[model samples]
Target: MLVAMALFALALERLIYWRVTHRRARRALIDAWIQRRDHVSWSALTLREVWTRELLARLRQPLPWLKLLVAVCPLLGLLGTVTGMIQVFDSLSLSDSGQARAMADGVARATLPTLVGMAVAVVGLLFVSRLEQIIRREDQRLHDRMARAVEDAHA
Candidate 1:
């Protein structure tokens, strides 16, 4: 249940983040499309440097939440697991067949938290990896364009 909730939340948050970045990138791309043809000028150096920095800044915004969620999820799950184990041991001491069975059930349920934690971590890592990749790609593209523009201007 917790895993499913995390999945839903992760998807929603990521979608919102992507949309915002894509919107900004699209606007920049459109505005710079003409700049694309123009010879790389001295000004392109400043613009590329500044823009690259901003891109990296924006790319990092979503990470804290993802990282926190990933980190917290496992601990929460572990708590459930330990609690479940305690109940299991408690029941074993009572020597009641029914209580033992119930305790076993609690232990099984305890695993759900861990499962949710791992799931969240996996999902978060995937997002982190993809974000880094996009940031690198976009930065590289801007860098290349700047180089080309500068070269063209001198040529």
Candidate 2:
């Protein structure tokens, strides 16, 4: 649950970075760099490539952790299920007669954790997919703008 929340927050932050807050900053940086005559040889394609790499790195930084956590959620659920089953088996062995209630309770406990884990994983994955899409679009846009900035500088 906590991991899922963190992933959601990361997705929101990325959305704000590209859609709300960073546009002006990006344009200003590009303009300032282009206006500097001394930096002409730095070249537009070169600048674009550098910025693309940096932005891509920043954009992709959280993805591996997000994927790992999402993947682990299911395993955690499975662990809960296994533990619950063990409890059920233990209760059965200890009781001379069948402990139907105890077994049922254990089964419920086992299933609940798996369900919770899967739920968290599903939610996390949804956010991850959206974040990736946004990142890809933003990356392309950044590349396009940087290419134009390079051309403007040369012009």
Candidate 3:
């Protein structure tokens, strides 16, 4: 369940990145800024700087939660490992005949969650890296677009 949740968050982040970086979305954002220019007391440059900062903040808002999930995955796996080991010890005490088989099964179960958690963390890390790149590129594009919009408004 935790793995599924992490994957879902990753997918959502990718979707958000795609939406934010799309040409149409970028244009719309700039257009909105242009519309608001006359209403605010701030100068065009100041407004642009504030808008850019806000945009980046909104884009990055979900990142910490996603990172938390990623970090938690391994700890959950460790918990599973501990529980499996406990079960193994319980079986060892209760059963004398099939001790080896029980221990082997328990060991396999113990390790599987760790493997799964690490795998999910790695996948989430990849998504986070790609999102970071997108954010950087979009930040530059937004700045350039806002500058042009300000220049046009001045002219």
Candidate 4:
């Protein structure tokens, strides 16, 4: 479930980035904003800053959820570890003949989830890092373009 949520969030972020960065979509948004308000009083610097903030907020909307998922993964693994240990104890109390084998199997089960969870978290970190880089680059590009557009409109 954690892995599925992470994948979904990643995909959503990518989709948002693609839509936000698309030229036509951005142009249309700017055009609508212009149509709704007076552009004469809005300075290029102010408009640039506002657009930058807005776009950055939109880009980062999914980050908190992703971070939460990353945090929860290890916790879920810990839960699994606890359960496996319980199973180990239960098995130990059950029989004298296969005690060692049961304990070994339980240990394997316990450790596997921890390893898998940590691995998933590492991959999620990478994904988050890459998404951040993309957002930063796009923010800069959008700010420059908006600044130019605002300047041109004012002129």
Q: Between prediction 3 and prediction 4, which has the larger TM-score?
A: 3
Error of 1 at 15 (Å): 3.5
Predicted candidate 1 versus true structure: per-residue lDDT over 1-155, tens digit per residue: 56447645875676676679655774574356435554346676566566667766676666676666667767777887787777777767777566756766777876876787677678767866776687678677766765665566558
Query: Per-model C-alpha lDDT, please?
Result: 0.66, 0.75, 0.75, 0.70
Q: Candidate 4 has what TM-score?
A: 0.74
Q: Write the per-residue lDDT of candidate 3 for residues 43-104, one digit (tens) a residue.
A: 86676777777777767767787777778888887888888888888878887776677789
Candidate 2 colliding pairs, count? 0
Clashing pairs in 3: none
Better of 2 and 4 by lDDT: 2
At residue 33, candidate 4 shows an lDDT of 49
The TM-scores, one per candidate, come to 0.67, 0.75, 0.79, 0.74
* Root-mean-square deviation per candidate: 4.3, 3.3, 3.5, 3.7
Model 3, global lDDT: 0.75
Error of 3 at 4 (Å): 3.5
By descending TM-score, how would the candidates be arranged?
Answer: 3, 2, 4, 1
Q: Candidate 3: worst 10 consecutive residues by lDDT?
A: 36-45
**Residue range 1-155, candidate 4, lDDT tens digits:** 65647665675766666675655656765665445445546584476467667757767778777877777787777777888788878878787776677678878887877777777777777777877887788777775666566677777
